[model samples]
Target: MSRGARFTERLDLLWLGATVGVGLLGLRLIHMQVVRNQHYSELAERQRTQVIAQAAPRGRVYDRNGDIVATNQPAFSLIFLPGKAQDPARLAGLADSLARELHRDRGELFERLLEAAREETAIHLAENLPLKTMFKLSELKTLYPGVDLIVEARRHYPYGAFAGHLLGYMGKIDRRQWQRLKGKGYRVDSWVGRSGVESRYEDVLRGVDGEIRMEVDAQGRLRRRLDEVPWQVGGNVLLTIDSRIQRAVEEGLRASPSGTGAAVALDPRTGEVLALASTPDFDPNLLLLPEWDSEKQAVASLPEFNRAVQGTYAPGSTFKIIMDAALLQESVVRLDERVFCPGFFQVGNRAFKCWEKKGHKWVDFLASLAHSCDTYYYSMGLRMKGPTIERYEKLFGLGRKTGLDLPGERSGNVFGPEARKARKRGWYDGDTANLSIGQGELLATPIQMALVAATVANKGTLWKPRFVKRLERPGRPPEDILSEPVGRVDLRPEVWDKVQEAMVGVVKGGTGQRVNIPGLVVGGKTGTSQNNLGDDHAWFIAWAARPGEVPSLALAVLIQHGGHGSSAAGPVARKAIEAAFDLASAKGHEAPAEGAM
Candidate 1:
């Protein structure tokens, strides 16, 4: 009973243990084959598939009359999928081959390849690939698994360096930008706007990238194309820039004696920026190249600097118009008021000299503006003081950003009581005298001075400056951008008329005589700004209109280190006016004279 019973019990226990083991194995099988089927399948699928991102083409930029400003050109890039070729040795060998073929540094290429592997991302070996190299790589693609040639778009500026500052240029997305923009469809190799309208409208100009999925073999060789998501192109931007006027403005800037300056042209009635030009501008197309070295060249003058809205300088006599407005509005000076000038005006212990050494012996208010009498303005500055001067300067949009639709605009300084206190300096009557004549601590951008002329042309209305006129988007209605009046100088009609008369007198027989045309009613002011750095800067601000018509074009031209406004800047204004009005008799326009303010 003892031995037989014990054997039977042991056999039953063994059977129970075997039954439990079988049930556990069956559950494990069910979990593996059914419960996690989709998950395992995806893991297996990923091992043999590769996704290639297709970059969307950037938007096109057009001028006012539909001329191309910036556009995209077809290009090719070499992409390497590090995930497909996970072996470090394989990646090193691929990098060596790419470096040799693409003429790149071997160490840099290997480092980039390793980084891509560590991040489990694709790396662009060569961008804007040459046609011959692209074809060679295409033929060798099957040999280097996970490597493919992809089509890309490069920005192209049709006008080269013309209006380069306004159009801006493209640059590779840096680490900081990639960190911020990766979630917004930006890849590590994405190109972004660096400045100007490109930067200001980056969101609208950037297109969403699409991806192409491909099935591959275990060796990372492509087997077949699976599917692709088409990319949506970016919207087109139409600027208010008139190509003809822009050309004229650029030519005018180049014509200056120093060949380094800025010019701004505006449509006074609509506040449209017809043309904005800066000399010594670099080609935006050059910046699109793979190895741009402008930053490394140590060039004396920065070609990328946008002087039209960024560079600030004393407005010189061009500021007298603002003073005239203030003077008339406050009854500080009448149209017939007279000021005696003997070449210099005494302010405290300092004697401020006029541009005209001999001076206009006795000049009336209108003649004071036309002749740019510094002594007359000095007398007026004593009465106006710093606060009154600042008020009018701000009213004319000086010492502030003009709100131009461009990046890197500098709000020029207007040093008065507040600014002097901030700088721990005393405000003096000499400072007021200097400021009253557009000198001293006052600073103004070319765009702001252009607005001053625009204000006068549009009859005291300060219209908001506009660059973009329309946006044409895919599957959307064309959007028109309208600029509303931002401010107005509420001066009596007679006051504006008297100011206009003085401006006309300037062009007719005084400082700005060179800007006068045969049949055009042109009003302008000349300025020779004192610069401590070098020679005085020449300036001319003007407004042009046909007889009995509203002023259409208002412009300001500033020539750095140029000797005289009439000689260096006035001719540029005339050329711009000729282009604006299509004046055929411009060849017969008067030659600029030296020594005029």
Candidate 2:
């Protein structure tokens, strides 16, 4: 074949290939533009658009009686979106207009806008807006496109400071917490529960955020609105608290001109906390506010401490309940045993004097308990081993945390060999004498002491203390927070019988007489713990029931620097008991008839 003919054929083939490539490109473009137009448009919009997220409202908190304690109220906030103040030349004029309309300082708003613009963040100019300002913003929304008025959820506690410690408070997540929640929809402005039930149930209370995507021009100005996503609000949380009982107990704790103290009341049978009151409590709303640094510090100081679980102190004579049980349980002491108190117990030349300076000569077991004779307990301690009392302390839920649901619980020192090793001290007989009388290295929290009373009232069963009973999740059955007995006292039923008898005697005629309520059978013990820093800490633990029957409620009351147990803390317990009776009557919790329990 000729060279010219071959070249012509090659040229024709190349032309055909180029034409086919062009046609395929045209078809691909047509398919992308026409068949998948929405897909390509979304891709283009995504390249230009930015998403702004809005926080979802947190869950509400309710009490056991179905009364709302914490909830969200519709609120508005003035936010500075940088895209609205794009032009540097027009920024000051825009800020001046905002200042006049929103009553903010022009210079301050300008600074905020400048910062948000530089950082490219949506900054809150003003929050918790007044109704007048909110209405004005709504009317002038079109005039100030950059100044967005968004409806937000403001946390509201309707009962003021009621159950503040138990309910906890909300605050922005710190740097450390942010690391754990980076992908969990947490942002710089995101708030989390810092303490109490709110902290414990953060996963259940915090809701997912929603966002809206908006297309912006090259100058960072909004061009058009795009895709949007809505938020799913959190579920409601129900606490195991009785509002009436909580108020009454808090009032009782504050009734006295006292400085620091705690009082806890609960159903001994179920370990359901009815009332947990600490005198030094704070209004969570006030603590979470900005520009309230000093106020927050004041509330965060010692006075606001949750003494019910966090305050550890010598339980004083209230600890005698444990001592009595240990001795009776271990068969270390006999009911027929007699001890004579000449105001002091002598151990190797050291004399531990009783609160009563005079002598109660030759008192028996029941009489000794009614009188709170230190000498009798000292004698009992002398018979036991050095670590016996300490071992029993663990059994009685002292020297250990009660496994309470609240945060910052303390496992107070139950002076034993282990504690002695920790403190670098050798065990001694004098320590046992002090331990016998509920003194020296032995320390306990108000909740722990309350558990002691509960154990006795429940006939030696130590139920795990809890604040929440059930979680009321949205569109689901009630989830019961079940808890079993943490421990059980080793004493026999008859031992508890004798111990109950002694406790009854103390309330009826002994140091706890002041806590006795008329027409109710009450069992209690008084404690006056010595304090080197100030006056003695007064304490009282009690339980109330129908005459000659098992108790339904148990309480522990402690007053720091209070003079004497009955004089300072007894009246408080009495008031709470009276309120409990009143609440029972109002709720129609009458005694069961026929064969019912």
Candidate 3:
């Protein structure tokens, strides 16, 4: 009970209490470092750093000869940063100023800023800012704090709308698109390929985005760069399309009566798409602008339809080639057999009229094909009784998608026995006759028709049509895509021989004379198909050089509202064939242009 002993015990108790408190603090520190370290670290980063995505340049699209089809250029955008804005109320005023400067709806831009503010993210007010606008914005920086200006890469189509449909366009990513692409590093504001080749080859064309980490103070003012990650350049896409021949085809279609249609020319042996043209096309450059949607919607014919691969039109008399091929394949008709036509043929109390009001008195099988005699086709069709024409159609790459390497390709519709059953109707002689003449339930795209011409010219070998020839990445070996063969038609060479002879006669002495090019020995068929539409769609399919000559090229043309194939589409096909010959002779054929592809 001594006073000194009591004082020593009290001192020891105080020391022990202090030691326990110190130990507990150390344990809490360890727990934070071990269990909640990442969480705290991320919180710290979110508070002090801003992650800015640096867009990687997209790959360029090139023609066969390395001509530029699509590329990228530096562009500026006026941005609104809600976090950096001095006053949230000032966003409306800033939006109005930007709208006035950029010629946009002031109220809509204001609403967009408010929506972005609620989401706590930056919003782009205007894109593709001109130098003058950038300079003006720079001068007014004092008036608008947090009105950020950023650099971006916007798509540039050097050829404008030359291959617009195939080239496609880029647009702001929506929630649905972002959901699909977010896992692949696509941000909410990312621009994605919405259509065409841009959409089909998005993975190949989209470059890896770089990231910049910026340090900021409590007030959200940028201090300095904390880290940076450089981006990987996108790979290049070299298409089989030839711009020279493509231009010629476009010009030729422009000169046509309808001034709106599609043309596709391919190498019969390789299925390389030499030229694909859809007239009435709008410039892709316009698609990048704010007014693009309205401008495009104003056009009566949607240019984005890409009629070459997407349009489903009645093949018209051009389908006679397939009908005859069926006759030869089924052994139902002989080349020497004769059928009489007196302008019209009667089937089940109904009559199908020929192009000629007073038809030729009598014509053999070859003559039938040469003159596109409707009555002869009507008679031949009535004999088949089943899906003979449909079977022939499948053999010649019709009644289905030609498998062209473009988006939005349609598998053309044709009524076979199965199709008739599906439609709850029985196949009739009249139906057979109508289908035989390419009138009734037959629908085909220009690419399909072109493939048919190519199949015939390839001596029954059907090759899958291809647009892209190779893939090229800078500082890397190019990836070449050789020609792909879909399948070969197993008909006798003599069948094609007879068909070729008749097609040549079509150009030499019949309806397809307009497509006859000197020294080329062209073989072609003209088609004027009827529809409920005001005028029939004119169609022509031709091969340059003669059959048995390993034809260099084959083409198909369609003119919407055009009256006759021979006059409306024939000349365009002829001109496109000529252009192909010229492009072949050019040195660019052997090698790409300098700084190209």
Write model 2 residue lDDT over 1-597, tens digit each, in one string.
799999999999999999999999999999988989999786555445667777788888889889999887877877655553366656677687767766667898788778877766656666667677678766544565556677878777898789888898887789988988978889866788988888998887788888877776544546667878987787778887888778877777777657568899988989989889887777887765443245656666545479899988888777778888778888888889888889888899888887777867888788887878888888888897658888888888887888897778989878877779887879888988888888898899999999999999988889889988777666678788986798888689898988888999887777777766667888998888788998888888998897766798899999887767877787778777887777332222122111100
Per-residue C-alpha lDDT of model 3 across residues 315-339, encoded as one tens digit per residue: 9889888887778878989888999
Worst 10 residues of 3 by lDDT: 588-597
| Order of candidate numbers by TM-score, starting with the best | 1, 3, 2
Question: What is candidate 1's CA lDDT for residue 332?
Answer: 88
- Clashing residue pairs in candidate 3, if any? none
Q: Which parts of model 2 are misplaced by more than 4 Å?
A: 1-52, 89-112, 115-123, 130-145, 212-228, 290-304, 421-424, 583-597
> Which candidate has the highest lDDT of all?
1
Considering lDDT, which of the candidate structures 1 and 2 is the better prediction for this target? 1
Per-candidate clashes come to: 0, 0, 0
- Regions of candidate 1 where Cα sits further than 4 Å from its true position: 1-22, 81-87, 111-123, 135-139, 292-303, 418-425, 592-596
Off by over 4 Å in 3: 1-49, 81-85, 103-123, 214-227, 291-303, 416-418, 473-477, 546-548, 583-597
Clashes of 1: 0
CA lDDT of each prediction against the hidden true structure: 0.84, 0.79, 0.79
